[model samples]
Target chain A: MKHLLSINDLGADGINEVCRLADLFTEVSQRPIPKVPALRGKTVAMLFYEDSTRTRLSFEVAARRLSADVMGFSVSSSSVNKGESVRDTVNTISAMGPDALVVRHRSAGVPHQVTGWTSAGVINAGDGWHEHPTQALLDCYTIRDRLGSVAGRRIVILGDIKHSRVARSCVMAFTSLGAKVTLVAPPTLLPPAVDSWPVDVSFSLDAVLSDCDVVYGLRVQHERQAEALLPSLREYTAQWGLTVDRAARLPVGALVMHPGPVNRGVEIAPEVLDQPNATLNEQVRHGVAVRMAVLYLLLAADPDLHPEGEAS
Target chain B: MSTVIKGGLVIDQTGERTADVVVDDGRIVAVGTDLSGDEILDASGCVVAPGFVDLHAHLRQPGAEEAETIETGSWAAIRGGFSAVVAMPNTNPPIDCAAVVQEVLALGAKAPCDVYTSGAITVERKGAQLAPMAEMAELGVRLFTDDGNGVQEAGLMRRAMEYAAGLGVILAQHCEVDSLAAGGHMHEGEWSSRLGIPGVPAEAEELMVMRDIALSRFTGAPVHFQHLSTRGSIAMVRAARQAGVAVTAEAATHHFTLTDEDCASYDPVFKVNPPLRPADDRDAVREGLADGAVDAIATDHAPHTMDAKERPFDQAPPGMLGLETALALALTELNLPVAEVVGLLSWRPAAIAGLKGVHGGPIVPDAPANLCVFDPQETWTVDPHDTASRSRNNPYAERTVRGRVRHTIVGGQTVLVDQVMRP
Candidate 1:
């Protein structure tokens, strides 16, 4: 309940509860004004340390929608740039009396470390190549929203895996929701161990493409190219990149998705991003709802926040 | 520094014999029916073989201390029954220069195991340029690799092989080409299809293995393939060896013990580079071990902090620490003569790492006394929570395993006894 660092920490009931709450939040997003007073008057801080437009803004938007005061922490402009350590930044922010904290860092455990800094319920927005719990939750909401339940379905995450925090988090969330997850990435992208995670893994994209009902594609950061995680952009697009030809090989109804900032020629073709079933934009919409659910659950769901037991 | 291993079957490449070996001042003083020393250690019903030698290990020190350090990795090495291990060069500064290599070597000076290191083949593992291999080689680095990445460019790799051959150093490859492997997270197969995860074809790894084999042929260099998980890669390596291409390959214990089906659980613990291959490949890895296709059982001991490894399968760092449990897992997973298995764990890899002068053994008098005493028949389950490494990324926890190292002695020092790390 403290830090959702691992899916094993979340059991069947916990997953079902999160999924149920996500559904309820999705319904609330359908209403006009799209706001909730559950976390009204509370402060939720957003600490974003990496390149993220969607996850960063959505947590802010979600906290705002829940009527919780929001503070956006930028790494480059803060004391972090002026030689501040993670512990120092966290302690400095803890003094602000935030009721809940939304942290996204380049290192994987920073959010888990926030617990040592403050008592405010921590929501891992994203950690470096670690879990982006909200993204996984949103992706789960997207899958369960379209499909009735995720108990036995198959989900495949594609691309830039050596560097994608979303894929890591999604697998944790999906597996918890009881959907089987297969991670498909080049060996260069794949790490040397998965014994800790409870997921199926593979190397060939075609192995799981046809069976996957939900396909998540990731962006290939060009900066990683400078590091030679790949040989050439042209080569990667040709072999591993998702093209129209490759998409047609999927199960007839497999939905497509990309985390965004699309590379027209790299991981996925441009047309796939625009495809009706892509859900690339819909993912953005669901992202906010999922964040709202997370904020509500962590900040307002417990009566301890309102020691007076004022409101539901 | 004086101790005696009494009442054990001394097994090594030469053969197995019942003996008591005495070690004094970091060297084996005597091996006979009754050997006495300043200290007496119980080795009854255990195999007294040369200490295990690991060909692959990633000690993420200096920059990534939160994951693993030389001291911790060495502690793991001793617990897993290894006396020496070759530290990979993919650290923060990257072991491309002589200074960084020295730093790692110096750090390992007081470690439980003798830590030999490999220098990067490509500077920063960029795959475009070459690293200062000759200089590092001059420092007695016997292996060279941009191990986290194979030199993607054939020309660069060919040149590296040429240079490596001239220096008499082995080029160890991660053996994955970007074109075939990029964007894929797991092994490309039916399991991947069912899971909706993008798949990386066996060719992603195979193609590189194939390319390197050809490069070895072209340059007449010896290349070591690190963590051969795919059947195709093993088959090719087998064929290349039969063709006399001067090559050797090491398979990780995870490859033989686990399959892609383990990934079906959607756990990050099974998320590894050269992702777990299919069952057939797992079988092939075992066969490769039995048939001598794989020269050694390397741990590929890569450690990542819990958060780095706690993420989803696709985002976690691709490695698990094996130094602490490799020997037990190897014996349990591979169906082979214990002596043969010890060869894979010890002398075979010692020869490969060029530490045969001291590390791996025949348990003879005047040997370096780097040794392990283990009850080959004992059974136990792995528990990550008890590991000596800074990171607890072990996927083997709670799984019952037979064959455990009861004691590990590195250079006559008792680093492990009764399966406990002395340090």
Candidate 2:
């Protein structure tokens, strides 16, 4: 895979390969040294045009753990604030000879556009309501690690699916891995053509709660309330939040997952995070390993050269 | 100067005939079998037709010259077989008044093709108060519009239409309800849901179209809808026209030829106003043009620099360069006869742009010699870099399209000959 721009870019086989590589990286991350010489000579550039803390740090940590150099350019600190065009900024970073560019922008297709301007393999960290492939990969790895395999698992993604890149990518990743995915959100918060999405959609989160093996909650912004997509945060929390009542009603061995910075009282009740099966932290932990695997795939390990048993 | 357009099938609203058109002193001197003149423009195996008129073109002069200017846009117009083009007034310090209108006309006076200016219906195109329509109309600004924006207020639009009717002018609307269209980068559809970009629902355009048609019916004034892209909008316009309301609509070239599915690449070139819709809407637009529901094929010929277009799909400004490719795309994509296509490109739009007498032709004696000679069978791939406009945002780049304009004569002047611009 030259780029991990979308989960769709990594089909079933590609996704499984990443998950397998992530297993090895997870083991390395647990080591005392917690580092690998796999990508020592390569450099990964982080081009975060949007304000991101966890995603940027997660990628930086992932690259560093694999011993790859990390170069970061946040929008606020860069020449982009001075009216530099995306092309110019990309060209400036591209001149530095990075093996891959991890791009996160407020626009849906910046990373795709960046690929045309540079030779580097482009990874979408997150783009506006588009795919956050790494987040989806990490979510996939988390599910696979817990459930043996994702096949036939019932996954429910709920929240502002319209504005959440996590929801978009996770739906594709989970469904492609043979999981039965259902999207739960208010009609206003759901994407316009949600019916066309592979997943079955329900307005009430409660309807799909019992059948779900994994319930993924996206962060609900307060601004969506002001935009009239929701009446208020309190109403959203009452309807869709993974409240204590909803958490207690889940079937045995069912897991809770969220791509964080969680809205503790909105999409998920503060008490629900205390549940033993809540995999929020594990999602973040798997993030590094999954991203490391991605970097390895795009920059270091040639699958054809070191296929199967030889990859270790 | 005298010239003879030799050996071509001449087509116009008056129909087709094998004629050699002889031009002298800015008028068609004669049309006969063996016409001779001081010079001959070889039109062998070509159709000599009336030069097209663009009811909507953004000659981004007085502002945004980095994208296009009167000189450059005019060159593109004549190259695309256009004898005249109505410059849309969405510029920096817009053509909202007589001064800007006169300025555009003065600049157009020197251009290769006749460039007419459309006055903004609202001052600064802000959709607030009415622009000085009386002064603007006096300067030959027959079409009034807020091209980049619809007059958002129904009352304001009704007043503007009533006012425009009094001045003997037409109000052209770029039909988009801002509230519905807010934060939308592309059409709201399955592709938008998959791509995760914010969608502008088809209702956003249709609602305003519906409103304007009602307003036109109420005000008894002529309303022209610009670049109608949706099936619902076309149906409403057709219904309204049938009901005897003075409503005329034009479809942009992209709307009929390309669909929202093209936005899957997330390329901003496909991002245009009244954003390309689904295949259903594209088919509806084609059907509208095939019948008389859609009056003209206007190239909402917007231009943007590569720097602007290279931005991310949502961040990038919406528009594609249309002036250079509209004719070829129409001929290649639409399953219409050569005469019908010519009518859509030329006379129909000419009547809408108020350039009927001077531009759209009958190939009769003492008629203005605005003509285009094009080989409809010639197939050529589009090269975005090979544009007359300063910017290169042509979505049809690398697309192999049939029909090539061989020569363009504007007012007895051969501005383009043998597929090359004249000095």
Candidate 3:
């Protein structure tokens, strides 16, 4: 794929290929040196237009581990703060010849727009309520590592599916991997056209919790709550929050995941983060390896660099 | 100086006839079998009709001249077989009062097409207080609208309707409830869910359409619905018409020709206000047009600069250039007879825009000679870069469409002849 902007951009076979490549990177991550010379001379730029701590740090670590040079564009200090247009900013950074441009913008399709302006392999880190392909990939990697496979798995993505790019991408990735995905959120938290999605949707989280092989909690965007999308944080936590009782109801050995800077007691119980089944920390770790796979596949998969022949 | 448009089947509200039209001193002096003038413009095997009139278009003048000025928009309108267009009241400073209306009218005086200005229904389109309807109406502004946004307050909209009724002016609405349509970039449907773009539910538009229909009934004033994009909105309009409500509606060319699925590419060009809807909604728009439930195919010709349009689909302003492609798209996409198509583009919209005597015509003598000659069978691909407007946001670029405007005569002056603008 020219760009990892959406999970839908990768079909079942393409997703499987990415997972297989990520397996090799996962092995590299466990090594004593934990470094690879695959992307030795390449450079990757991380353009974060939105405030991000985990995603930004994970991508920077991934690039460095691959021995690739990294350039980070901070929205606060860059020309973006001076009202520079996305095109102007992309062009300015593109002139430096970064092989892959990992962009995270508050707008849905900024990564797609960047693709048109630059030759750099564009990666959608996390755009506004749109797909975050790398997050989905890491989630898939975590799921496969624990459960052996995602196919036929009952995956329930819970919480604010409407505002969660993670939910959108995970639904797409999981469904492509043959998982039967169910989206659980309040009617308002679900997108208006959720019925048309590949996954079935449910509002009652407790009813589906026991049947799920994976209970993925999406962050309830508190910013949207000010618009009265929700009644209040208390009501939301009461209804959709993955509390201790809900976590205990999950099928034995079923994984519980969250794409964090978790709201603690809002989308998930504060105690749930410390649970043995909670893969939130593992998701962050897998994020590095999966992103390393993506960068290597996109930037350094030339025939000369791939001495063992291509992954395909 | 005079021009003769010869050897074409002249079709107008009065019907079709083989005629040669002669124009002089900004009026059609003769239209008969063998009329002749000092200049002859060939129109063989073409449908010669009154130039089209758009009830809604954003000329973006006074403040947003970077996207479109009256001169450039007029050229685009003429190239699309339009002799007149009602410039929407949603410009930068907005045409909310007599001064802005007068300024737009003055700019239109030098344009190729007759540019009529619509005043805002609410002051500055804020939906709080009524604009100076009397002053604007006195300046010959027949239509008032808070277009780009609907006047959200029911009381204010009612007051504006009553005031407009008293002034003998029509109020047009852009029909979207802000609360429901907020943060939405495309119609809420299958594509929107899959693409994960925030969706504007059809009900957001339907609720306002329902409100306006009731408002029209209560106030006994005519309301023109702009760019009705949903099945529910069209069905409501159809039912309202059946109930004898004094409401007229126009659908944009994109509403009937495109759908929300086009937003799959996440291209902001397909992103428009009332956003492209589902397939059923698209079909309903077409059905509304063919069955006369809809009055005119108005081009909501909104022009945004390339830089503005290049933003991500959600952040980008909603609009697309339509003045240069509306007629061709109508001809290519709608399954209607050429005569009915001409009526939608010509007399029907001309009447709606209150440009009857000056624009849409019977093509008879002394009719001011606003006419268009087009080959209905001819086909051409749209190139956005070839547009006359200052912006390049045409969604129909690379689309091969049948029918083309060959010549346009506005006020007896040959503005466009053989697809070339007259200097």
Candidate 4:
């Protein structure tokens, strides 16, 4: 567990191990004094080249909870805008002797590139259209919390599978955990070679609604409409959105999940988030704990120190 | 001053022979037994052949000197056994006008290797207005292209082809439809899907190749395809040539040697414009070279600084150091005869760049003394730091490659001896 760059890096066992460790962190997150000395004296740096709110804040909370010092480099305020290359920024930050770097960039492989530039462990907060491993781990934890186990569950990831890092990560994480993932999107919104993925594909949300154990709604980026990936968000919503009607079609206790900063009445109806089975809030809550587990695993806990740490 | 290249099996357009070639006044004066001259260049255990001619090279001179200058790129070319290299016009102030073309030629005048340049098909390569091809052609610019960007509008390309046909110059296209290739950082395939990078579909290249073939037929002008990577594009070119559409194609060394799978490491060094494709496409390119469908093997040797390549995959500029590695890669990766590989790298590309009688050799009396001496079986690993080009974005760095240049002669000058460039 040198870095959590991709969900694919974590196999079925690694996924389960993360979920289990996240369970321990979730318990600690509930305690009145949640701070732990597990990562004390260690430092974690945030290099978010892209604008991120939830992911950055979640990681900050998680690092603080584990008692690790946190340093941040926002692109807008930093030397990045002064024409400093990603390599220079990473090298400069790495010189400060951080144990791990949490990187988010608008390019798919920036985190992977950062790994080469720095000796520190790397956690991909989110890279462009690529995997958001922590988000996926947290999603796995949220699902396991609700359904008790991910195995044998039917998970339908809906909308914008082409550009959503969340959907890419979730599909890998859920499918790795033995949950069958069905990706539902307009043919244009789906990735060009999604057929190679270990998942079923559907065009209509209505068709797959009754069969799913979990409906993972991906945010339909409105900018894609301008790119002509979709005709309009209204059309995307009418076709693939987890609307009030579509949510009603799910069998009793079927979960609705969305990685946050959701556009209301776009990928989902306004009332859908209010549903009891909706796990958007839970996904956010689990994001912090999952990140705490990841930071602990990368920065604090030694593999030999863990009771049954499988060689990754 | 006369020089004798001794103990080499000379392979040229006229075929192979064990000959001691004597050069004086920039022309071969003798090709016979025990030739004596003022200077001796030992070519023992070497295949002395016509020096390779690269139809595509980005010397990055006139601008972007931080990446490559004419002197450095030409020296790299000499090291790679290329006596001549055509500079692509994608520099900062692109080689579009007569003055720019003249400036590039003058700058390359003192280079160890011959540096010819391609004039831009459009002004500044913006693809909107036609460049002064005739004026640039008068300065010996033989090939014209908007290399980094394909001329997108069909009508504009048709007009450019008509103009090039009249000017008696060939228009080489980079063969990408910008609308189709928009925002794509690599080849669109299962690998790209897995990597989550936006993809440029093979159709983006094929569509333009298809369009140019039609335009060539319509205008009755010859169109040359640059760095044809996709299998479909090769098939189209093969068919169009069979149909006598006057289309010639060249494959870059990397297209046949590396694939899109190389981009999995997320190292931007592997990121190229026509982006490395799948093994199937790479094999197709190889087959195209083996057959007569592909005419030449050019080093689309674009150079970029380390800082530029250090950016993320999508943000990093696409190119790799190629002038230093083309011949070795062709010899190591392609399962073709040495002569055929030489033809692909030398005579064939020389013909495409309109350097027929001047460069590609017959190794007889009065032929230009441009020759390369190489041990085809010698192996050397590529080291980016050891190269003469001002960039280190070599994807083949650390890759063991066969066929090293032993000696290179340009215009009767021994520019490289015993694998070292003359100071």
Candidate 5:
């Protein structure tokens, strides 16, 4: 409860509570003022060791709308470029007294390590090929909004499960919410230990599309192609891409989703990204509300911040 | 000065007897019931055996002194009941030449225990060119390794093995194909998938084991597999040994005591090369030890500074301190006879490291008096802060372990008396 490092860290009740708070924030976003005092006087610092415009912007907007001060640490221009160790960097930032730290690093478990260095609540934005809990939360919220409930839903996560932190988080979040997830990817693209995952896995994407209520396509990095994990991008699209034909084959009212910066004509067709059923934009919009809910819950629950007498 | 270790059950390669061992001028002069000497060290209700020999240990010296030095590592060895340890050659500016080897040997001269240096199989351990094996061999370097990394190039490894064959020395491999283990911080298993940490598949190590076995067969040379962790690796080593492949292997203590599940906390202290495997692999390692498929229980006693290990699990370097905990863990975890435990810790590894005459013993007259006395039933918890090594990255901290070294004698001198280092 102190940190949102992974979806596994939150059980079903915790996930539902965040979704409920996010619903309230979604209503707040529609208001004329579009702001809340839930996190008034609190400070949230985004310490990004990786370059991420969308996640950084989402967290910044979320904190600002909750009336919490925000600070951004750019890895490229900051002391990180001077070869400062993670401990020293976190200690220096923590000395400035932020109520919480949102970290995104290229190495998995960086946020977990930061938790040991500082007493502030730590939220994992993204870590290398690891869990991205907030993204999974926003995705789950978007799913609940569309489908009424996540229970009994059949979600198919497609493509590059090995390198996709989003896929890893979604599998845990969806499974914990009583949904059955089937991951579809090339054997090489799937993780080495995917056989032990909570979800069932398949190689052919078309075979499972009919039973799926949600088709989630993960971004494929062109850089990884050099490692030759896959034969080629052309081969990847022919088999796994959510092309126009494949999207049309989905069950009526089923949702199509992607954690964005989509690889058009690669993981998904360009037209699929703009379809009415596509929830990528909604995922982005809900990111802020979910992050706001997380910050509110973490800071408002702190005894030092709210105090027992002033909680109301 | 002469010393008498009395009233202890003496167990060694020759078997057990209740005798007082007398030592003078660095050799055992007598072994009898009513023996006396210039000094008497009490060893009642204890087992006296030859001090353990560690075939693998990273004594970071002549570089990275912040983590470990020869003197501090030697103290740790003696405390762990080790009278002799083979210093791995993976230090910065590695022990590839006669100069570095001689420098480490000179450093070991002042240490509490004997420190033998292994020369690098490749120049600078880069896996490209062969190091000056002939020169290092002349200086008494018996083992060669590019440890902390496997020689990735097969051609280079074969050539090194052939040259090692020519020199009549042994080549030890860390056994990981870098391409398969790249970007991996832990073993590929259920826990890795759940935790989302990139993993090194068991095949990464198996492939190298397979390659080296082929290389050894082709070159007719001896190959020593270091820290064998996976079940497949153990099975293959066992079959190869049965097939007369002239291959010897050593498993580290952590390989059996811990697993990939320990990585669920994402602590770098548990992150090691050929990273901790699953329970089946751990069972296989134990089986290998029990059935003589594995020759020695080596402590890959790697020491890393707190700052280096403070990074995230994936970014942090791999390794942990082992010299101070190897025997205790073996006694606590392995369901084997006391004499067999001594064999794994002392004679077996001593033979592998080629220190037979000087180290591992029968405890008979005229043998070098390198011995350890330990109570196999005593229990103690590990504290990282209370260590002789310069580093504080001990993974066994807070773990309660049975058995403890009571005294250690090296070259007839009681280096560790009653569990405290002597000045």
Candidate 6:
């Protein structure tokens, strides 16, 4: 409930609160001179030990618009790559007195460990093939925004869910939000633990496509999967794809969405990803706003935890 | 109690001598003819020196219990005539901080041979950062490395070397660049091409070794290159050492005996990091050992569970068990003089690992009773089925070779005797 490391950590109330905050934050973002003093002077530091463009910049822009001081730490240019231990760097960065720290890493549980090493609140911004909790947050917020809350909607997540941190987090959030989630994969792309998750599981995308209101697609990280897991790319796409034809076969008024960096026509059909009914682009817009609300709620926890004490 | 090792010609890096060594209270008390002792072992047709030292071996405990443990790995070490071996730091919980290092040491306390562990240079082997070298070194971890990965950035490596130089601990590298080695399942060469298996180029390893040597030269830190496989890598190490730069090199026994040709069968057993190179490179590793360009013959003994390693060759993890079969293969395959082979196995590695003070010795009085007795000319066949390691992934099973272990002593403890494992 305190740190959204995974949806399994959030209960029903937690999803509602984040969704409510996201809606208010998005409305405020549309106002002229969108800035909030809710977390004035509190600092948020994004410490990405892995490479990123969207996640890093979104958090950066979100914190800035909240009038919170920011310290952006990048692994590529920083002393971290110089054999500096993650604990040492996180400890030292914590010494600078940031109110909240966002961490991204290539290894799972890095952020989980960083939270233990510092007093600063921690957010998991993608760690290995683990949870990217906030990506799930924005995604949930975007779905709720369109469907007036997705409590009764049937959602089907397609593509490489086994390797997706977002899929893991999204499943936790959506299921807790009262939505029915059916995970569709080609069996080779589903984790061994997939059947154990609190969601309906199916190997054939066609089996679930008919009844789903939201068709969420995942990227096929061809580079990361063990070669023996799946055969050729063309073969994987043919069996588990969300092509436009497949999209049309879904229940009427269904939407197709992807958490970007699409392997065009590989996981989701290109035409389906760009369809007006799909909410992929809307998700990106809602991302920065929902992140802004999260930054505020996390950093402005108390009055005494003020900004003037932070920047120095 | 006193024990006498009778009639073995001792060949060590120091020199060759024929002597009867006497041990009392676990220390080598005398080395001469007509030595008196409470127990005596005949060693007439063998060579005796300090115990062999392995620069690389994985004692996978505190995490992957199904593969290996400190106790079983030590038994394997002694049965192969190694009185000591360095344990790699990648485990369930890595040996990064002092706590993990201390834990590994505690686990190694009752093992058959002396077990010293390398501390991870990067926390959790995520090469995005370096681990605490000074703290780990303070706990007596003399070497540091992210053995599964080389620090990708040259700047990170330079800084690590500078810190390592300041602490006087050596830095060992796995010699791989992530970008270059990505998605590769085997060595990128003719065999891989023919088999259609995705390949990792030899450059992926050589490039990192070359960088580490340059970093060592820049920081004046002694860098130890682990399992040098490429001909280019051996050439670089030879040049660097010749130039008086502080660097030492080791080659795994597989590098000397095996080739990429083995991967043709799509056997997961042959898959390993710094993947098997061609025959020419294998010959270079042998020549490097013969010419002293490569200072030691390390095992790079990696172990994996049956289910984990028995998967498709491209999907299975890299590494093969090495501790139980390294010496016999070196003895039979290299065809070097017994004394010189001992140098590569025992003394030279001891010196390189900075363990000479306690491990490699002259079998003289007042020294640690760390020793091994082996029959130099005994013929044997490698049988993975007979190994003491917990896993069944050794690729060298059922191969014929010569020479075998007779007994091993560590700090005066008879951990292995007459080829039988002892406590």
Question: Model 3 — TM-score against the truth?
Answer: 0.97
lDDT of 3 by residue, B1-423 (tens): 989999999999889888898989989989888778899999999999999999988899989999999999999999999999999888878899999988999999999888899999888899888889999999999998889898899988888888888888899999999988887888877788777788888999999999999999999999999999888899999999999999999999999999888887778998899899888989999999999999999999999999888888888899999988888889889989999999999999988878778888989988888999999999999999997889999998899999999999988889898899996
- Structure candidate 3, residue pairs in collision: none
Better of 1 and 3 by TM-score: 3
List TM-scores for all candidates, in order.
0.65, 0.98, 0.97, 0.98, 0.96, 0.59
Candidate 3 lDDT tens digits, A229-285:
798889999998999998888889999998887888998998988989999989999
* Model 1, docking class: incorrect
**CAPRI grade of model 6:** incorrect
Per-prediction share of native contacts kept: 0.00, 0.88, 0.66, 0.82, 0.70, 0.00
- Model 5 chain A: weakest 10-residue lDDT segment is A303-312
Model 5 vs truth, CA RMSD: 2.8
Better of 5 and 6 by TM-score: 5
TM-score of chain A taken by itself, candidate 5: 0.96
Whole-structure CA lDDT of model 5: 0.91
As for TM-score, the candidate ahead, 4 or 6, is: 4
The models' CA-based lDDT, in order, is 0.81, 0.91, 0.89, 0.90, 0.91, 0.81
Task: Give the per-residue lDDT of model 2 (tens digit) for B12-125.
Answer: 988899989999999999999998999999988999999999999999988899999999999999889999999999999899998888889999999999999999999899
Segments in model 5 whose C-alpha atoms lie over 4 Å from true places:
A302-312
Worst 10 residues of 5 chain B by lDDT: B189-198
Higher-scoring candidate on DockQ, 4 or 6: 4
> Which 10 consecutive residues of model 3 chain B have the lowest summed lDDT?
B188-197
State the displacement of the C-alpha of residue B311, model 4, in Å, after optimal TM-score superposition.
Answer: 1.1
Q: Put the candidates in lDDT order, highest first.
A: 5, 2, 4, 3, 6, 1
Q: Is the docking of candidate 2 incorrect, acceptable, medium or high quality?
A: high
Q: Per-residue CA lDDT of candidate 2, range A46-90, in tens?
A: 998888888899999999998999998978888989999988998
TM-score of predicted model 5?
Answer: 0.96
